[model samples]
Target: MSRICKPYAAIRTFLLLLCGWVPLLTALGAAGQTRIYDIRYGNNAIGTLETKQETTGSTRRITLKSRVQMKLLSRMEVDIFAEYRHNVLHAAKATRLQGKSSADSKETSTEKSANGYTVIRKGERSILHHARITYCVSDLYFTEPREIRQVYSETLGVLLPLKLAADKRYELTMPDGKRSYYRYEKGKLKEVEISHALGKAFFTAREGA
Candidate 1:
């Protein structure tokens, strides 16, 4: 009877090791190559959220964290974490034409990185493709009207509200047409009053919170 119990116990222990420990170990291995996020700026915002994202490299994997400071009219500062993800490869490898990128951090009056980003192995230390980074955003760019909001929308893959509708999701009728949709609030179309080069481009939210 004791021998029979021993085999069952061994089987249970083996299951525990396989189910519990292996994934944790793989995650630990992936950890070394993941992205790290931070709000590098925004404590003293000028007119709007003036934050930046940054990462430090070691050896295993690529890391990243997207942070923002919702600065409005040079008054309030709402520090927030927006989005993040990771693979073996870092952003540099995900969108770069040649050397390392400076788009993630180092705040200045200078323009955004045109080098693009990539997504390959952190161990590989290089990128494969080229995707341009956001170049510029105007004042009231975070929240404003449509005509002015198009710049921000374009960066986020949205079309102007005029040629496009705010009640449903569809492709942009603009030159850069793709599967775009109108975002919603509490069953009402939320409005984004932005400041853009073309005056004001209002992107209203749709019906649904």
Candidate 2:
């Protein structure tokens, strides 16, 4: 990881928590819907700024025919076809290949993706690796970004600031005006509260967006 990319990676981990635990909130619907967000925060020569958000509307449920792109290296690209449901997952043509980050100590495995999509084992009971896909490639030759989403049902309602009951309530923190705050509650969540340095913000899902 480059000095500049470390912070983004850290924030990406935070996003994993934010989205990974959303369903654990007791206030959530049994099989309502889930959001896989891509939120990030970091500091660079530009300055200190905070930006975090979750995928809204559609695009949350990557279904059987879902396919996304991954740029491997400069002038190179690989595609990721996501097919997941409940727990079991399978990739069409995913394979192990080396990457710039292949040499990194944190790398668990190397996957050379041509047209082959990768596989993610079923649920927390299965493999720990949820499948990491290289996102983009550039002339700068940076480590390609990957997505990590792990499911832990037993972990539900165990950790603080995490869940309520059976999809009852959930909590999270993100960039507000000045500072961000964690919002959590009990019972059905009519709305969610997000705290800021000055005050707080409330959000309600659109009826059917």
Candidate 3:
């Protein structure tokens, strides 16, 4: 009878520990905020874009992922990741893959250095002469840049010009002489129109929030 009681007591103790951790585990899982966008070409749905942000103490992590069907047989995907500590850039990386081939992939990485920032692309390294970078292209998806004059492009490894257009929308000029327009409603990003040489693509908020 004593042995039976001991086993029952151990079972109760294990259940108590499990109950204590359930809420903490749920909170940890819910630590990030995610927003989804539907990528469209004209009236056709081509792909989806998802962005997530998570913050722990003073460090913040932001990630963006998207897959687009460029043509009947051509598929392209993009993944971008950035980390910031105390509102300053720590490191960022971007990768672009064509179709299902890794040989047709391109990657760009940027890291914070004591002097400024180091950008690596195509196995070559270059220095960016900046004291600090507080805002980047990824931040534009979550935060409306009404007063921001310039923003860092993690993919291009350079700064791009941001300006308010005559129509009250924000436009960012890319390195390839193409301009992307961002439209915000109620201080939140609602839609983005990106122009390509072949056509245009739009990213509309899925939840409309």
Instruction: Output the number of the TM-score-best candidate.
Output: 3
| lDDT-superior candidate, 1 or 3 | 3
* Per-residue lDDT of model 2, residues 50-96, tens digit only: 11112223221221111111232211112222222232222222111
Q: Which digits, one per residue and each the tens of the lDDT, describe model 3 over residues 28-103? A: 4434868888877667787777878777866777788876663444666778888877668889888877668899
lDDT of 1 by residue, 1-209 (tens): 65433332222211111000011233334332221212112133112212222222332221112222222311121222212122121122111111134432221111112453322222232332334322112111121223322321212222232323555422222333322233334322233332222222233322231
CA RMSD, predictions in order: 22.2, 14.4, 18.6
Considering TM-score, which of the candidate structures 1 and 3 is the better prediction for this target? 3
Can you tell me which runs of candidate 1 are displaced by over 4 Å? Answer: 1-149, 152-176, 186-209
What order do you get sorting by TM-score, best first?
3, 2, 1
Q: Pick the candidate with the highest lDDT.
A: 3
Quality of model 1 by C-alpha lDDT: 0.24
